[model samples]
Target: MDERDGKHQDAAQPEFRPYHHPAAGWGAAKSVTEFLVRERELVNGPRAIMKMNHENGGFDCPGCAWPDDTKGLHLDICENGIKHVTWEMTRKRVDREFFAAHPVAELAEWSDFDLEDQGRLTEPMRYDPASDHYVPISWAEAFALVGRTLQELDSPDQAAFYTSGRLGNEATFLYQLMAREFGTNNLPDCSNMCHEASGRALQASLGTGKGTVDLKDWEMTDALFILGVNAASNAPRMLTALAEAYRRGAQIVHINPLVEAASTRTIIPHEFARMATFRPTRTGTLNLQPRIGGDMALVRGMAKAVLEEQKSDPKALDVEFIERHTAGFAEYRALCEATSWDEIERQSGVGRAEILTAARVYCEADRSIVSWCLGVTQHEHGVDTVREIVNLLLMRGNLGREGAGPSPVRGHSNVQGNRTCGIDHRPDEAFLQRLAGVCDIDPPRAHGLDTVGTVEAMHRGDVKVFVGMGGNFALAAPDTPYTSAALRKCLLTVHVSTKLNRSHLVHGRQALILPCLGRTEKDHQRGSLQATSVEDSMSMVHLSVGMKRPASPHLLSEPAIIAGMARAALPGSNTPWEKYVEDYDRIRDTMAQVLDGFEDFNRRVRLPLGFRLRQPARELVFRTPSGRAEFSTAALPDVVPVAGTLALGTMRSHDQWNTTIYSDNDRYRGIKNLRTLVFMNADDMRDRGIRRFDDVDITSTARDGSTRTLRRYKAIPYDIPRGCAAGYMPEMNVLCAIGDYSTQSDQPLMKHLKVTVEASQPAG
Candidate 1:
């Protein structure tokens, strides 16, 4: 690698073609083979890791939140899970010599893949502005520097603490405990960017903020509505569930602007014959392609159809359930009656025929479920759209019953678990009182900043220190340049991480990278190998015990690191930080005290396959303000873009998970060896006088007359909506301003943007 003028050596020209195969069969096999070949030096390690991954007594796959069966079945992991595992357990290492040879300035310009590809961090390191490189530092000095910086701050509010989804419940509890004890509520996390909309919307309508359905619900559902969830890429394990539902003769409907490969076909990983024949089973019996930001209108149309059907048979409308279990139904029904089909089609970009087809499927099923992902959450009307979905479910009384409810397919492994474990900026009074009673520390009451709030606060010169427990905050947050500038302006930035990322390069005046044990590595503290717990997508809390040895002797567990920092920062605190680290069960004991649903935490988590947490919404107990389920209504997103602009959708390639790029190829989308390519409709390209593979510049036109532009993106004509274009995230994240988020949830509209595309070079 060159020391100056940074550029990736592995960056390829990229070959693009139409992918015609099913989602998960031979193609998935090839991807796993490639991962194995790349990590050949890590010999027998691969076989052993695969045998234990996602099992009852094994470590959890730190990728997506899709639940595991814990059977230790044959090759129990998917292609995406294997990529995350090998990437984490790779033989490559980043030691003192590696940093000495490369400067931070040069590394900052490296590709995201290259930055992480350098390998696992081995020890604590500090940034030296004079030399433009990082140097080794003692753990004590690192902690002392951070504590002194906190002491020197005017108030704890100036310091922001961020967490990621990979952390266990115990570690997250301690991390949040430290943040609250230090008198700041700035506990921003990945959930703020991805599923905050789901939580906020559901909590307002139902009592709980979690999904009400579990894996067993798939077997009972007669029909499923999958909105904006890409099963092939984001959560491949769900495809198995979909296939099982199909075998049981369940109808599935898919709605999205971009027609994903998995939406049409799938292969169950455990079904040996299906994997061998490559004869994929159909997933979506009916697919609806709504316009960008049109999910609310589509669901509204579905509700309209449901009401119209009730005119023929009043029983079609669950009158008894609505009267006994819900509120605001009369107002919601009146609004639907007043809504026009023409208006619905105009806003949703779907004709009456397709809308009626989906409604028919919904009306015919005795038991139904609606599942969605980021595509439904990362929009201006994200929360409204989710509530509309709930409105549809209420029409049929599809909630509080077997195989019926709403499920938001979360992205990270334990994102929902993190929130349940108290990683919130706004803590409830009851939770705070319980925490204070046990920890003997006066926790902060003021609501802290979310992800966007932190970036804006830093930009306005309000924040001085940023301590990231995990995750690449710089690249993950919206408005990349602005967030990076905010990080650079900080007094100090500290990252407790297992590997290097873009967040480390966008440093403050003084920065530190504190190496920590990865999920795949054994976290042996106080002479005993410890196990952590991760709550899955279905609200199942299970034990995760690492099998592989620690990658580095110097690395510490995340809990140990957090406890050490807490001791240094709160010198006079009475909390037994070290005692909890000695045995994680003590931490669990403490959790059982402050948190609900964890009564007998140690005893329950130790059981085979662990246990499922309580979800009050599933028990016909709507804990809303009115003590009943509520229905919500909102104006349709009538966002008519300018004449020259096309609605843009930012997506993740199949090869990546979150901000980490596992490879340069995405065979699922048929783009090989490149991340700079953009997917557009062929007709849209023709209308814009652009050809396939033509290098273009995307200019994002914000409402404030301010704009952000990305250069050198090769436009590839593919299958998408006529007026919509799609590109990978972080590359397109620059175009979205941090302030341009949903009005209620404040989730960055990464999936919806107003943009105009043109040739890279002027009219030659």
Candidate 2:
């Protein structure tokens, strides 16, 4: 093994202790302080930057996609938000000197955390295979190289453009426009891996794909059903809303295989009175632990219970709304009625009594909200599960009303906005016509490759040039080994990134690292300070203007980088690429003309809390082919458990963001200094003759009859349901095959890996 590989090694032995404390108290504060100091931002840290996060006219946090509070409360940041800001505002630099000292091979051996911890990239760098290192390249040279390589491709389809949620609306608009004009719709993004199922299912059911509820709905809702989400870590800012709702006598039901600490209790750090008194509020009134891949059956069971109660009292369901606003209810109701209790129990791994209890809660509430994250989307039956959730909400007349709807909690700050700005592989025909009329370019009509399709295309040698707008694609994608191999097959790869990550190391024969300005960094173009816009999970669009100076003078904004590449690659195009870069308003102006719901983009975006895009489903307007919200009759997933394997789900740790590890600890789960530990049920571990902290090898078989293994992962007994196991992502992502994706949405089933575990021998 290389010596550099050992630099950020995990603890020699893992430590396990049950953490009984509420989420987000002194513990969260301490973690935030430690990260600020470690990133060298302590003295001039969170107090200054956090004040601007999610505030009016300030930069939106590059964290989760939770909407900003309408009241604009002071210190509108969470612990994870603080970590994200400090991590971006670090003083460390990964300049030419650092690359000169470390070869690409050696850096490849370093952990993901260490690579990003090296700090921000200072300038453009290109891979020199002869020297086995990256050397600095001028911006003009970089642009010329990218253009020359792209122009040389036999077909425009030979290139693929990927986007990350970190980009703002203006940049994403230019990015998609550039790619479509360049003649391909091969725009795969982070959404393909996480919430594609949500969008696909929601769009099918309700004409629109976005959530219907906003932050204010949380205050008025009588019941909140949080499904398959780990709120404490993934969306910490959401805890304040949950706590407030709990305090106001709202019924909160948490349904997941694992009993997450944050779902049970929490103390909002910003609430001075509660923080000082250490009074923890109970966030969840009921917690349900279903087997992995069992959400569809559980949701069906709840529907069945509701239907049974409806037989006794017609008021149990909003019959009037169903007849007036929805279609396919009769068939859906029949499907639920025909599903027997025994079958529901067998498939869901939940008792009928408990399912009925949850159903009763939903039936009693006049207004209800159903929210979910990756847990509900990263499954083979993810789309079906999401559709079932909508069916439950639809039964209660949840659409087009305040405090009643579906909320697919997005993780990335602007992932939802990326989609809103037209970052799609298969854009609709209306959007294309409008874009063509507005931009005077004929876009390709052919459907393009998605994330999984991009990998397949690259492997088949169809794609030659790959350009990423701002994400660690290598680590974020599933089938890590397969994705890496596919990435290497590209003729040239480019990443517009803020810091060094795993994607930089696993490169194509030729690669370019184009460092861009972070969200907290000021973007000054042509002597004018610029601001970009992003859309939150609730469809709220707002401007984000950076307050801090750029980490390096050479760093360019994402818009500038996209415009540079577009100008170089398509010199013959008539689009005003240079003008778009000079001022972002030009980009927004064009976007307003092209996109729906952004007619007055520039003026509306500058409003106090920005503007709420038109959500048709929120106003009882269904865009579906039937012109009504449709009830899904999709069958329950065949969840027959394999006798010897456990259903494992990949998750993020408390000290981590999506695909970015902040530390080797999961404080909420009571695990310390380890990222390779698998949380298993105590009975399951005992049944398998595995003890706590025992080194175990986990093997998963793909649908193609091929198997992958992760060796020597410590097995920790925890409170998860039997026949299910949980582990941190990216590490376990290797076990997820590229072919193991939702047939409906094409999202990798990262949350449903059927694996068998056995004790492994210690290394000799």
lDDT of 1 by residue, 1-764 (tens): 00111122355677898788888888887777877888763474466556544555678888888887645465657888878888888788999999999999889767898889888999999999999999999999999999899989999999999999998899999999999999999999999999999999899999789889988887689999999888899998888788778877999999998778888787766678877777788877888988888788999999999999988978778888889999999899889888899999888889999999999999999999999999899988899999999989988999999999998999899999999999999889999999999889899899999999999988888999999988899989998888999999999999998889999999899999999998888888878989999899889988888877878899999999999888889999898999999999999999999998999999998887788999898998988999999999676778555677888988899989888988777788888877776788898889888898887888887766678888767889887877788888867788888778888898888988888888787534
| Candidate 2 lDDT tens digits, 431-472 | 999999999999999999999999989988999999999889
Off by over 4 Å in 1: 1-11, 41-45, 52-55, 70-74, 762-764
Instruction: Give candidates' CA RMSD values in order.
Output: 2.4, 1.9
Candidate No. with top TM-score: 2
lDDT of each: 0.87, 0.90
lDDT of 2: 0.90
TM-score, per-candidate, Cα-based: 0.97, 0.98
